[model samples]
Target: MFKLLLFCFLIGITVGIGLLTTFLYANTSIVNQVFLRDKYSKLQCIWLLVFLTGCSLLLYYTFSSQALYYSLIFMNPSLEPLQFWDALWVVGITDFVVKFYFMGLKCLILLVPSVMMSHKCKGFWYMCLEEISQYYCTLVSTPVWFRYLIDYGAQTSRAEWHFGILLALLYLIIKLFFVFGQWKTSADVLRLFFTQPSYGMAATKRQCSEAEDICAICQAEFTKPIVLVCQHIFCEECICLWFNREKTCPLCRTVISSHNHKYKDGATSLQLRLF
Candidate 1:
């Protein structure tokens, strides 16, 4: 039961982090756009690998001493010990690679902030040494927390377990709300464009003229183009992808809206949604 709870906690943390990153990436800023474009954006994949590796390690530690070996021998009376050793070697090497990758990511995350700060200091060497020391200390310190969590679980304190579960559930609820808002916005946008009888499936050349001859996203000739409220045009998929991240025109950075321009109190600015 404790092991099950531990796994649940880890899964919750993974999902919470993923949702947070997705929400942040959905921003219309240049930074987020670049991040989306980059092939190295694989936080979800990394988290999944880490989760699987951790579970394997945990199970290995729990049963490896005698229990696991005896069980394997009893289950397969004719199986050769040499074959077991061969399989273990393969699994061990894969586990080491996953662990190494995770450690590298952790080190990179810690190092980047310190390196960014080092440029502002005159004592460059001292700053570099300090940053290096800080990173090492942090790397070492993480195991202490893991040890504490493991020890706490062994003690089976209900209060701590309950609190952790509550926090994770809260994060999941917030993630659900974010997802709902995103889906609603997308549905509304699509309905506004596709429901037009005259435009129907494709925009006329006159409408297409509002955008450039080429799609900015794919760098190809405009195909199935959609004109944004800002008069900037892009391929239907390309612009939708951009809008999913941010509610703004990519070229001019004008806020996107389906409402026709309106006049009220002499204000001509596009009215942003409260959400």
Candidate 2:
């Protein structure tokens, strides 16, 4: 199984790189269009480069551990140890490379909208929050405008005041807490985009006592766990129902005070809901 997965990873990395490279080379016009639209400063460019490298390393490290964990299963079995070691080597390296390529794909599709929104706004912070709120709302309601609103902060969403508070707090953090504000600028925007993935997935990250990936309410494993801003992952249905009745998150006991529904991207981001 490990060997097969490794082989698949190699194939995926090859295909991903080939596909993205072709897109870049073939559609030079589109590439130029994106650059023109999202013109980053030298500092921002350096930050992005450093950030991507770090994230890639993190992904590689995480998946490598997973690979090692899976390989241990073979050690206890009657499998050929030498063959298994070879398989682990091939698969682990391939997994890292594929993740690298996939990150590039994400940059093309996800980064543009996020960066463009980040740069163009007067209310970068709250707009970021509202963007997250919309993303969270889409997971459970089956509403007509779920995806559209989350990505765009629909007519009903409180994007204006949402962005307002964010901007004000950001200003306060930067002005008063200047020493700890090195990450405030880019972090404000990233906190918004990732807090609510622009896709239809509701992946809020709140904490749950159980690690089984089963919803406490329904006791069903989610097809995709909705990670709330709370660093908790749960069945989307459970959290949605919980959020609707009580203005508090289920696991963390954090008040769901803001109808705006957004937090940052850390354990300290304060367990909050975006959708």
Best by TM-score: 1
Residue 19 CA displacement from its true place in model 2, Å? 22
Candidate 1, residue 246: lDDT? 54
Model 2 TM-score is 0.21
TM of each candidate vs. truth: 0.28, 0.21
Our tally of clashes for model 1 stands at 1
What tens digits encode model 2's per-residue C-alpha lDDT throughout 77-192? 12232233444343333333333333333233324454354322212233354333332322212221122223232233688546544654554444445334434544555664
Q: Which portions of model 1 miss their true places by more than 4 Å?
A: 1-202, 209-212, 257-275
lDDT of 1 by residue, 91-187 (tens): 2322232333333333233233323532112122222322332233223322222223333333467787666456545645664576565555445
